[model samples]
Target: DVKVTQSSRYLVKRTGEKVFLECVQDMDHENMFWYRQDPGLGLRLIYFSYDVKMKEKGDIPEGYSVSREKKERFSLILESASTNQTSMYLCASSLLGLWATEQYFGPGTRLTVT
Candidate 1:
């Protein structure tokens, strides 16, 4: 089955610490993305990779970046976690960013930086 799994369901960290969230997909999708989801704010892209070792900053890339070392794995890293940065992190994957492509999302990771 095609699925994506996140490394954590919830996270709590002190302010100013580095944080890492991992994601993995099993469908060999070529596109992977990291997004932040907040109530009534919708999903905002953090970063994405179209292929292994190919990364691009998305709309909301500040303080966050991504790594795609393998076709099926993508990782989101917060350079330094902050209270204002606390939000739900979602990982997603798509076969390709074609006209009819649909992204599949992971369960999500709720992060709290205090």
Candidate 2:
């Protein structure tokens, strides 16, 4: 079965530390996305990559960056973590063609910055 997995389910970091969140999909999807879920903000996209080594900034890409070295892997990097960035980070993957509407979401990584 195809699955999307995150490197960590829970993470805690200092206010100024750098954080790396990794996501991998076994489905060979061409599109991968990073989103953060906050209480009132719902799901805000941080970054998305359509193909390997190609990334695009999403709705909320201020403090975050993304890397896509391989087709099945996508990484989200927080240069300097802050308390305000603390939230549940979600990763999703979908096909790029007509079925692009369907996305498979990872379990999520809840990051806490103290």
| Cα error of candidate 2 at position 93, Å | 0.2
Estimated TM-score for each candidate:
0.96, 0.97
For model 1, give the 10-residue run with minimal summed lDDT: 93-102
lDDT of 1 by residue, 44-107 (tens): 9999999999999999898887888889999999888989889999999998756737899999
How badly does each model clash, as a count of residue pairs? 0, 0
lDDT of each: 0.93, 0.96
Local error of candidate 2 at residue 31 (angstroms):
0.2
Candidate 2 wrong stretches, greater than 4 Å? none
